[model samples]
Every structure is written in structure tokens, then in C-alpha cells.
Target: MSLEIRSLEIRIAASTDADAACTVLRRSITECCDLDHKNDPAILDAWLGNKTPQMVANWFNSPTNFSLVAVSEGVVVGVALLTGAGKLALCYLLPEARGQGVGKALLARMEEQACSWGVKALQLHSTATGQEFFARRGYVDAGKVRSPYGVETVFFWKQLDAGAEAPDGGKRKRFCNCNPV
Candidate 1:
């Protein structure tokens, strides 16, 4: 059953969104990323060890990180984080939100944010489940590396046209209708 996202909002995550965003992050890893974790208790536990609400809140509040959440019908269905060093730190969506454009919207917004920040490129370690998604979005695979959780991950990077400036003069563009609230 596909979830028809009638009203989806992408916005900068606030402290109050930590709980729901954490839920999305955990659920996406546990449920949607079976290929990466393979239902192994040890790997799952290690990967999820620090995915607490408090940690998520800290990520949202960090000055060096930009966090965003995808809300559908007032529920956080997706979460993404971009580091100031041009790393695409986190990008995950609930299982039901897959193939629903939420990931694309989140990624587009992240790229826009990176460009606004004068980031020349965005880099990430994509799990098996996310490799194709990132590839389809123009990310080039650099090589494979074993994640800390023992999962084989692909390193991907995308060069951005950072020379382009937003109409508002270097501010992030609302490319995917994402609000920075």
C-alpha cells in the first residue's frame, strides 16, 4: 500500500521535532534498511545506539549542522542533516514514505542549502539501500567502505554549482518549497 502524501511540508527542524524525527530515523533504519543491517541484532543495536531524542535535539540545535524534517499530515516522516563541512550526514525516510518524493525533496533542499553556504560539493556514505537513490540524484560513487556497523557502504559525492546565487542574495532557495522555520 502506497502512502499518498497529500500535504507534505519540509522545514528546518526545531527542538520540539526531535522526538518525531528520532522516531523516523530509527524506524527508517530498522524497518526500511533491511539490506544494510540484515536484521542482525548486533549491527542494529550498534547503529541505533545513539539515535536518541536528546541526540537528535542536539543535532538540530547544533550551529554547524543543518537539520530538516519532512512532515506529512503533521507527522515527521523523514529526517535529514547536513554538516557545515559539506557532508550529507543523515538522510532517512520512513518505509511508507519511500518512493513518495520525500527523499528527493529533502535532498534537493539540502543541496540548495549547501550551495547557499558556498559548498563546492556534498559527500555522504550511502548504505546499500540508499546507493541507488543517491546515484539517481546525480551523486557519483567514489568507492566502498565498511561502515562502523560493519555494513558495506558506498561513498558518494556530488559537485554543486555553488557559483549560482539565490535571488535573495546567498540565502537558501526554497527550491522544494521547503521553509526554514
Candidate 2:
């Protein structure tokens, strides 16, 4: 089945919006991200400690970072952050907001923003739940790395040049063989 949502707008996130954005990110990490933490309270605490509103505000104030928020009906549903060096810093959505094309839309908008800045590629670390999502979008798995929060994350990267197409004029390959748990 196809899911469609209305009134979804992606816009640059403002510093004043950091608290709301941080709340969404914290909730998403503490709730929907069990694929990595396995519902362990200690792990959740350690992870969420870094997702404070102040950190989000710092991201908002950073000159080299581009932050975007997805809003619907005046509520922030998702957020995407990227650095000028093409690092896909953060992409998070509330639990009820998942599997409804929010992340895909956010990623597309971020990619467009990066392309406008002449960025040729983007790289990110992903949880198991997010690995398949990124893979489906043509981000090839580069390997695994331990996150600062002590979770093993999959590293992925995708070239953003020429509309993500191969030089041979064929469609780009997707690494989406992962089965969702």
C-alpha cells in the first residue's frame, strides 16, 4: 500500500526551534531505535544524553552545518542535518511518523541542498533499522563502525553527482537486500 501525507514542508531549522527538534530526536532514539539499543535503559540513557536541546541549538548555530526540519500542521515531524563536507549528520523522525515517506523526502531535500553547494557525495552512519532505508536509496554500505554511544553502526555513502546515475547511463545500484526486523 502507498502512504501519502499532506502539508509536509522541509525548511531550514531555526535556533529557536531546537527544543522541539531535540524532543523529536530524543523520542525517536529512545523509542523507535530499539534495533540498536534493544530497549536497554542504560544504553538509552547514554545515547539520549547527547541528544540535548543545547546540542541541537549548537547545530542550528553552526555555519558549516545545514539543518532542515519537516513540518506538518505547524509541528515538526522530522529533521535532517548535514555538514558542508557532505556528512549526513542526523535524520530522525518521530515513531508515529515512520514508514510514511518522511525520511525519504527529507533525504531528497538534503541531497538537493548539498548539490546546490557543489557537494559530490554524502556519508552517514546508520542503525540497523535505518540501514535498509539508506541502502534502498542507493547508499552503499562501506562497513561497520562503533558509534560514540557504543552502538555498532553501518557506514554508508553515496555519490550525488550526475543525479546519482552511473556513467554508463544505467540506473544506480541499490544495496537494499536487508530484511527488516
The lDDT leader among the candidates is 1
The most accurate candidate by TM-score is 1
Q: Tell me each candidate's RMSD, in Å, in order.
A: 6.2, 6.7
On residues 1-181, what C-alpha lDDT tens digit does candidate 1 reach at each position?
4677888999999999999999998999999889999999999999999899999999999999999999999989899999999999999998898988999999999998987887777899999999999999878899999988788999998767534355467843233322332
User: Model 2: per-residue lDDT, tens digit, 41-130?
Assistant: 888888888788899999989999999998877888899999999999999997778887889989998888777787777899999879
Clashing pairs in 1: none
The whole-model lDDT of each prediction reads 0.89, 0.84
What TM value does model 1 have?
0.88
Give the count of colliding residue pairs in each prediction.
Answer: 0, 0
